[model samples]
Target: MSRASRLLTLLQMLRGKSRPVTAATLASELEVSERTLYRDIAELTALGAPIYGEAGIGYVLRSGLFLPPLMLNADETEAVVLGLRYVDQRGDEELSKAAADAMAKIAAVLAPRPRTHCAIRPCCPARRATASPTTRCRSMCSARRSAFRPRC
Candidate 1:
């Protein structure tokens, strides 16, 4: 993958976890050297991706920031779908529908053609975990909106 693509992958990986990810893991996943990963991270930071971390710990993207449409890639698209699916499975009827609705809205807003096809059915096996899918969906919806529409 290109540097830009690698950087986008890094962002997507960070989005999946609720915790910081180590540079080593990122490098291994992206098939890059640790030094290359660090440079890529620096490049993303310079571009104002809300990456947060320090040496030996890891890095995280701040949850509430809105990312530009141009920054999202194919893997990121799948990440979004997976996240929404998890939320949908755990949510109450209202919230579950809301998650589906949010996905629809995202599909509607996507740029025409190939970008639009990024919307796909998430096939995550429904989890039996006792957590609030409603809350997760709400938070994701809020964060997605924040990424697009700036705060006043």
Candidate 2:
């Protein structure tokens, strides 16, 4: 299997476990060397996967905002496609590239037939904005901040 496929499989294995799994066990299951497994873990972490742990200790894949079990139906898959599509269109170069990578990861798990349900449109984005994503993300917190103000 390709490195990409192997990495996805590795991720699946990690997800199946609730506790940390040693490198030797993972390497044995993946049919790869311990050295290569370490590298793959690093690569996944770099790609924004919430993988944690060290060399001898083993690794664990923690659930984060965007990662569910990936047991998505066609409609759900379409929704993810639409949202990531928006990120691709309006985000800056780095953001756009990250979005592309994320899209690829989503695709890796979904079958081609289900993906056909999604509308892959190169749709236009609204006029470019000066604000960075970080700034825009902070702006989204304003509504909640007032609601959760300190109870002094």
Candidate that scores best on TM-score: 1
lDDT of 2 at 98: 78
- lDDT per residue for candidate 2 within 1-152, as digits (tens), equals 89999999898778656589999999999999989998999999899988999757779887443364356886577557756766788889999877776775665455546544333554333332887887765654442333223343
RMSD of every candidate to native, in Å, equals 12.9, 15.8
Candidate 1 lDDT at 123 equals: 44
Candidate 1 — which residues are off by over 4 angstroms? Answer: 68-152
Model 2, position 17: C-alpha lDDT score:
67
Locate the minimum summed-lDDT window of 10 residues in model 1.
143-152
> Candidate 2: which pairs clash?
none
How good is model 2 by TM-score? 0.44
Worst 10 residues of 2 by lDDT: 143-152
Best-performing candidate as measured by lDDT: 2
On residues 118-151, what C-alpha lDDT tens digit does candidate 1 reach at each position?
Answer: 3443344433356599866666555444333323
- Residue 7 lDDT in candidate 2: 95
Q: What is candidate 2's CA lDDT for residue 39?
A: 96
lDDT per prediction?
0.66, 0.70
